[model samples]
Target: MAGRKRRTLTAPARIVLCLLLAGISGYFLYHCALDVLTTFQLKEQIAQNKSQISELEDEQTALQEQKEKLQDPEYLKYMVRGKYLVTKDGEQVFKLPTTQDDS
Candidate 1:
């Protein structure tokens, strides 16, 4: 009871200080929310890219195998015959309707 009362901010000063603090807090909250959203989006994009990369790698492997097969004359002959319906000389080809759509 003997100590002097501490000087406090006036009503207008207190209001202004509170308003400034609220503005700063809101700005920080908005920025933090934005960061979280951006992180989520980027993670999703990374996952999609990783899956795409794996798919492309698998396709590349398959294409490499096909290329290897093409280097062999027997496989090439079989592939051409099967895919293009080409035949050797004096060979007969029969065209049949497929059960499923071939294309």
Candidate 2:
């Protein structure tokens, strides 16, 4: 009968290999979770930014209309009188009373 030797890894080598595999798997899992979180955050940020952009565009349009209105002398005079209580020369200023009661 011939004798055969069995091949086996040492305890330290096995432990090291196990720790290495664990470390690699942990790193992969961590990065995968982080990637998901980052993607979610980016999507949220994009939606928020889009909303902000829409609001800014609306404001810009309103401002443009206001600018056009201000370019007209009659519109400017009306705005100044309504907003600032200002009157032109020889113009009579009248104040209207509000009918709403303050509770």
For residue 50, model 2's alpha carbon misses the true position, in angstroms, by 0.5
What is the C-alpha lDDT profile of model 1 across 3-91, one tens digit per residue? 97988999999999999999999999999999999999999999999999999999999999999999999999998998899998999
lDDT of 2 by residue, 1-103 (tens): 2688888999999999999999999999999999999999999999999999999999999999989999999998888899899987898888888798789
For every model shown, the clashing-pair count is: 0, 0
Q: What is the lDDT of residue 101 in candidate 1?
A: 75
78 in model 1: Cα distance from truth in Å? 0.9
RMSD values for the candidates in order, in angstroms, are 3.0, 3.3
- Roughly what TM-score does model 1 have, to 2 decimal places? 0.85
Per lDDT, the best of the predicted structures is: 1
lDDT of 2 at 21: 100
